[model samples]
Target: METGIYLIVTIVNKGWGDTVLEASMKAGAEGGTILLGRGVGIHEKQTILGISIEPEKEVVLSVTYPDKKDAILQEIVRAAELKKPGAGIAFVVPIAQVAGVVHLFHQGSQSNSEETK
Candidate 1:
């Protein structure tokens, strides 16, 4: 596997942004970016009746060491209560390249591992 970090973004129902951020941070993430969005799914009924449903959402993005991805994801899931339906979704995307933070990543990894051990 190529050695690099990952950025995890959790898109959840509105008002959960702070929870996600706190969870990630508690799991060894420094901080993250938050964005507002609108989610659309099954807006109308199949029958003749016309009904619409839209969900307001918040997207929380965080970057962390590849080794810490799993912990961070779990924290977010629990904090956001993602197990329940209509809560939200979480996913990770690989970061092929980065700059100016290699040292920070190494230091954080060391600190976290030491604490765990």
Candidate 2:
């Protein structure tokens, strides 16, 4: 089977996981998984005006069809306001094979084996 499968990973402030999910869903994403984490940047140990802190962040992992990848990514970016520095960052990677999600899609859409979600 040949398909265009893409995994979108978005990282943002701890409280922004739902925001990303909502935005993505509106833009055609079915669902995603959220993970909580603590991040240490290169400047994490540095003092900002004499203050140091460890920041907590949320990671959202979404998988989608190729046709919906760009729209979903853009919505997440807009909702997260990631254009500004330090807001957050997102990237995409392709998946060569996938399983356990075959039941989530509608039957009519399964005809084209080239782009199953």
Model 2, stretches more than 4 Å misplaced? 42-52, 104-117
Global CA lDDT computed for model 2: 0.82
Assess every candidate by TM-score: 0.74, 0.78
lDDT at residue 111 of model 2 (Cα atoms): 57
Model 1, residue 61: distance off in Å is 0.3
For all candidates in order, the CA lDDT equals 0.79, 0.82
Candidate 2 clashing pairs? none
What is the overall TM-score of model 1 with all chains considered together? 0.74
TM-score of 2: 0.78
Sliding window of 10 residues with minimal summed lDDT for model 1 = 40-49
Give the residue spans of candidate 1 off by over 4 A.
1-3, 41-51, 99-117
Best by TM-score: 2
How far residue 60's Cα lies from its native spot in candidate 1, in Å, is 0.2
